[model samples]
Target: MAAMWLLRTLLPLAPFARRMRHGMTLGVRAIAIGADRRVLLVRHTYSPGWHLPGGGVDVGETAVEAARRELLEETNTRAIGPLELHGVFFNPPVGGRDHVVCFRVPRFEMGPLPAPTYEIAEVGAFLIDALPETVTPATHRRLQEVASGAAPDDCW
Candidate 1:
């Protein structure tokens, strides 16, 4: 039991160590806007509130590929059309060396909404003007940037 606890406790440090060695880490987030003009958001079990579907970029995967994969995994939605790059933002809260590439998915095909998972508690599309109150501040800022035609800020 002590061994398991120790392993769990030290696991998070793995990413920091990897960042120190690799120099940087990258993640991807996708903004899937449906025909109704609603943007898809996810409520994660591991994290609080609603957020755009996204995850870390794997060793051999491009940012676009990671965004596509995260959308499908977190929302059961596939980006069937072109994914436009929104911006690359430095995610300071996660880490100074942690960066996130944002993509705007204008067209997609969703296989029915996903059920709750250990990673994702819920997934749904919401209007830009009426985001849920529990939505993460970062998420809200990102969406607001999208809605108002504002350029993505360099920092997240």
Candidate 2:
């Protein structure tokens, strides 16, 4: 009975399965913040939770490039040189993996901050110790480590 049920499900997704089998998976994520102790976050359109401003890495792009690109695209803020490597995490119980690069960015003191774009609805500097309630669990954990000054030179 179980075998028959599995076959039924597979039969309906045969075309999708074929397409997926030919696809390559790759991704990058970032943890960006400023010296003011405010981190960059985006409120996702699909999910109610807030997360770092990053997405999948393009096929030919380096993880660092992807992280910087995502941050600029999502928040219009450019990071300075040297992004610290925090941790790399795998998307468990799901597909793909992530190389999470963290940066303790300096504030945009040269000029006014740019408005948030993309799926982000709003953007503002918030105290790291008093983050909003919309942050995701994993993100919250990262924030805690950042706040506690315990994020060592190792993977999380």
Candidate 3:
């Protein structure tokens, strides 16, 4: 448990670690939608775009578990039912081929949204047609795919 806590605490340094590693890493992203069709998005302290709530998969954790954990930590939300696997994408955001597993939380319980922290700057749920202008292109694409039932691209 202590080891996991340490890993979570040092997660912000993952990008630097990725630059030194020679293999692909697995990460997870959650598409948490409410009953009214609004989707949750978060802005990070280090990044400039609004993105789905998620993070890197731990060494012994499954992608779904990582997605769930990230959603709970970032938005204080809990899935009320099974999560759907949206797709697996090869994301080259920081150079290496990092695969991100996208999950859809069709039903969930919302709690108080997280306050601004060292990692997350802001979080909110926005109507599908009224998303903020700063949303990441990849995140917008994923949302489109989810709405239209279109096939997702190989990359994120």
**TM-scores for every candidate against the unseen true structure:** 0.85, 0.69, 0.85
Candidate 3 regions off by >4 Å?
A: 1-20
TM-score of 3: 0.85
Q: What are the per-residue Cα lDDT tens digits for candidate 1 across 90-149?
A: 988775688989999988998999889888889988988889999998888889998899
Q: Could you give candidate 3's per-residue lDDT for residues 6-120 as a string of tens digits?
A: 9998998898786668667888999988879899999999989999999999988988889999999998999777899999998887555789899999889999988999999
Task: Give the residue spans of candidate 2 off by over 4 A.
Answer: 1-24, 96-118, 151-156
The lDDT for every candidate, in the order shown, is 0.89, 0.65, 0.91
Winning candidate number (lDDT): 3
Clashes of each: 0, 0, 0
Off by over 4 Å in 1: 1-22
Give the lDDT ranking, best first: 3, 1, 2
Put down candidate 2 lDDT per residue, 1-156, tens digits, no spaces.
999999998899988887677554445556666666677777766667777767777878987788778777776777777676666654543443323445444433222445544566665556787788878877787777767777443332
Worst 10-residue lDDT window for candidate 2 reads 103-112
